[model samples]
Target: MSNSLQYIFGGPKAWDSGLWTASDDRVRGGSSISHLYTHPTQAKFYGHLDTKTLGGAGFASQRTVGDLALDLSCTEGIKLSLGWDSSDQTFTLNVKDTIPGKREDGRDEAGVSWEYDFKAPENGGEIFMKWDEFKATYRGREVEDPEPLKLNDIKRISLMARSFFDKQDGDFKLYVNWIAAVKKDDNDSDDDGDLKKHALEQRSDPRPVWKRLFCGLL
Candidate 1:
């Protein structure tokens, strides 16, 4: 039997009240925006990325809301079924284990985060991330030393379109079929067969696409 991957977001549930978008325009004094549009079989993340105002540093993103509390300690990492149009741009997947209480002034307290960078495939493909592939970051910069990722209490997962220090900018689109917690298949030779089966299952699913494009946090 193949190792089963559990859908944490996307997949049959699709995007609902559990997702939201945030952009650097919040703090950078820019006009860049990000949006998430959900379909029956996929979610599309598209937006304009403006780096000029921030001097080659700007970002827009979508993230899971509330405490997911996803216990992925037993699994390897994440597997994303995705498609994209921008080959030169890089995207980031971020995970956080802790959500600090609000400060005295009502601002959020910053916490450590684990991040992984990836380039989208041309037509669309599966991207697998191993647990160790994540790097720790604090206040947007990589840290030399930080506490290990707490998989058991993982609170958030996010997808970001970043300027990468002026390397990229402008409009971007990413199509996501699903995001799941995956374990490496012990039987690597059957990988192609498993993927074919997954495609067939997706085609057979009868869920209808909700007309609404965006869903805020519940």
Candidate 2:
């Protein structure tokens, strides 16, 4: 892993079906979201949003392995490749606190302590979500300027694509790959204590008598 960032998910393999669940019920006219086996190299997530439900509010989401530790500190943002089957949808990315329920395997939901989001416009394009542009919301309200990620404490990441306007009926498909955190070089300390101490002593602190004598001879 880089000192600044690390990869969490969205590699070449398809998602493990047992770990993913979908919400198809259109509460207030919401559309159903589901994943399909596209080809050996890609997985496709597609669904519709209801314009009639919640007065035109719609949401659809897909989640992956939540059991791994995510390090986000070295990144300025996230980078990913995206392509849509159409040209009229935008996607939102969300991270949540750990789910408390139990799955069939008898493990409780993982803790998701943070979140970041991005909007993918309908240009069949890719996006690099910048850290400054990422809005940090907790308990439903925005947190005013949070600290940079520590990368060792991430719980989960998610993606959602919805209709900007309700009653809009069109088929949408979003393909994703190479989703990762991008690193930024900051004043990070290297964890090597011996190296750091040696450098500090050599630069400013006084040398031992033998070393001083050697320097005198030189």
Candidate 3:
């Protein structure tokens, strides 16, 4: 191993409830809603997902409050530590390279977003996703042969609980211990590296609690 350092994005000691906001299917006349509750040890994401209103299509997610100019160029992948998951439903993790401006009608203009969907772990574990694992998507549909993700300036991040074409719905809950960027080790092969465990212990930091981490942490 090259002994590269892992950069923290959202962790127990760094999570800020105000930094997460619900972005649900309400915009599409659906009732799906989600919330992110920040605790001392982890963050809880739970909500009721309704697909009836949208005719078997609905989604509820928690996204970063604002754009984050994060430079992940030095990192190879993202690491997510799972706490406890009540439902082993499929969830999506999204990263945006650019944020489009709002239209005159006060609605957001659609833009390309990189997304990676994974089945939530039944118990608790960690998942490391490489940059290539994310696919470019627009308005829920994958784009064919899209441009690469801008790793130097990651604009946004989101976690979503969506209805996979009406396959599943109802109440859902997910617990997350942390979200971080892992560096590529030198001994790693061409393929994704070994699934080594990421350190989960939250060490005591002496800095004042700041909600916006990208300002300095990145």
Give the local distance difference test score of model 2.
0.51
TM-score of each: 0.77, 0.60, 0.81
Task: Please give, for residues 87-184, the per-residue lDDT of candidate 3 as tens digits.
Answer: 77888999998988888877668889899888767788888888889899888889998988988678799999998879879998888888887765
Best of the two (1, 2) by lDDT: 1
Tens digits of per-residue lDDT, candidate 1, 91-189, equal: 889999987678777556666779999978987899999889999987678989788898756788888888777888899878888888874455542
Which ranges in model 2 have alpha carbons more than 4 Å from their true place?
1-6, 11-18, 23-31, 36-40, 84-86, 100-125, 138-151, 163-170, 186-218
Candidate 2 structure quality by residue, lDDT tens digits, 1-218:
44233343455444455555564434224555555434444456676655455565555666655443443444567776665553346556665434446767754433333555454455546577775666665432467676554443455566655544463434556776546566564344345685466455445634343222211111
Which RMSD does model 3 reach against the true structure?
7.8
Candidate 3 runs further than 4 Å off:
2-5, 186-218
lDDT of every model, 2 decimals: 0.72, 0.51, 0.76
Ranking by lDDT: 3, 1, 2
Give the Å error, residue 19, model 2. Answer: 4.0
RMSD of 1: 9.5
Best by lDDT: 3
Clashes in candidate 2: how many?
A: 13
